[model samples]
Target: MTEIIKAESLSFDTLLEETSFTVESGSTSIVVTGKEEVDACLVRLLLGFIRPASGRLFMFDTDISTFTDRELSAVRQRIGLIYASGGLVSNLKVWENVVLPLAYSNKFSREQIEQMGLAVLNRLGYSGKLMALPGHIPLFQKRLAGLARTMLMDPDLVIYESPLTGLNYNERNQFLRIAREFHLEKPGRTSLFLSSTPEIVPLLEDARVITFTQRQSS
Candidate 1:
């Protein structure tokens, strides 16, 4: 199997120590639970946003620690990250938020970008809210818009950060269903979920779950 992500002996100021795991290409894995600090640290580390104090970090077998800013940016384009709050631009409408990345990348013309954005949202069952600002939407729809944005790029790896927090049980299940929709449709795409709650673990289909615990101070 293709090794998409791997980290060994990952540590940061006692928040995480000796953390190791492998995420094979097309597979799903959940960082089941961890202290908030540690979870954020791991997400930043994986995205190459911040360097770990120690250990090896790899993306497709290339050590991320050795990557330059440009190289890391390129790597990031292949990864999709859904932040704790949806991460939509406050000023941009929902459709604008979804297509911004594609438009900025210059890989497609303006017409093509809009068509792709609409296609994604339609697939995810969003209609008539494309022009609405994210702040005006309900929390569930806001998150769904975020998922639509993430899906627009058809990223190689998708990372969801605390996607279920503050969601009611039904909302949480809907979120998982959306994720599974992607997984089922794109069997070759890998996903990584990071959260401090373990309740969502059982709902992840065929996911390899790992929990990161902070070491107690001596």
Candidate 2:
């Protein structure tokens, strides 16, 4: 498969000291040369949430630093993300949350969006919770809802931040199963970027586990 993202000699300074890393597609390799305070920024850049202070970042063959907000939005339309908190609207119903991005973009008809949401919800084992509000659902269900929301758009990449947090062992296993299914179903159609603390290493062994493993393996 062609590389979808590549970063070389990237450097940035957050609240603390300078940090640096180099990343490429196909493998979730990362190198952190500074304190832990800058980890969040590194995660953000990998997801295209923000630009690096210096160095080259390419998305699909184009340099991301060259894109304006409008251009970045266009780029983001092809990507999906599940924030650490799921990023669901508390006031929106489950169905609405699943289709919210498409609604915002006006990319799909109402019927099309509804169908897509239903299909993704079913795939993620969330078919019954479509009418519940985000606060009403259990954490596992919320995570599934978040996964549905991320996948509903059929994005080329899906970035998940601490997705399995606050879940029980069974729930964590279920989430991983769903993620594995999603990846297999897509088969390189979408790249999955997940961020979590070091404690989750064993759980994420099947994945190209980026965080500390990069250092160990290197």
The global C-alpha lDDT for each of the candidates, from Candidate 1 onward, is 0.82, 0.64
Candidate 2 lDDT by residue in tens digits, 40-97: 5655776568666777777767888788889887888777767656678899987788
Structure candidate 2, residue pairs in collision: none
Clashes of each: 0, 0
* 180: Cα error in model 2, Å: 1.5
Q: Which ten residues in a row have the lowest lDDT in candidate 2?
A: 15-24
Per-residue CA lDDT of model 1 for 1-218, tens digit only, reads 98999989888776777778888999888886555556677788998888888889899779998998999999998998887778889999888888888878888988888788878887777654778888888777777788888888789899988878878998888788889778767867998888888887888857889877555668
Give me the candidate number with maximum lDDT.
1
The TM-score that candidate 2 achieves is: 0.75
The local distance difference test score of model 2 is 0.64
C-alpha TM-score for every candidate: 0.90, 0.75
Which residue pairs in candidate 1 have backbone atoms (N, alpha carbon, C) closer than 3 angstroms, thus clashing?
none
Go through the candidates in order and give the C-alpha RMSD of each one to the true structure.
Answer: 2.0, 4.6
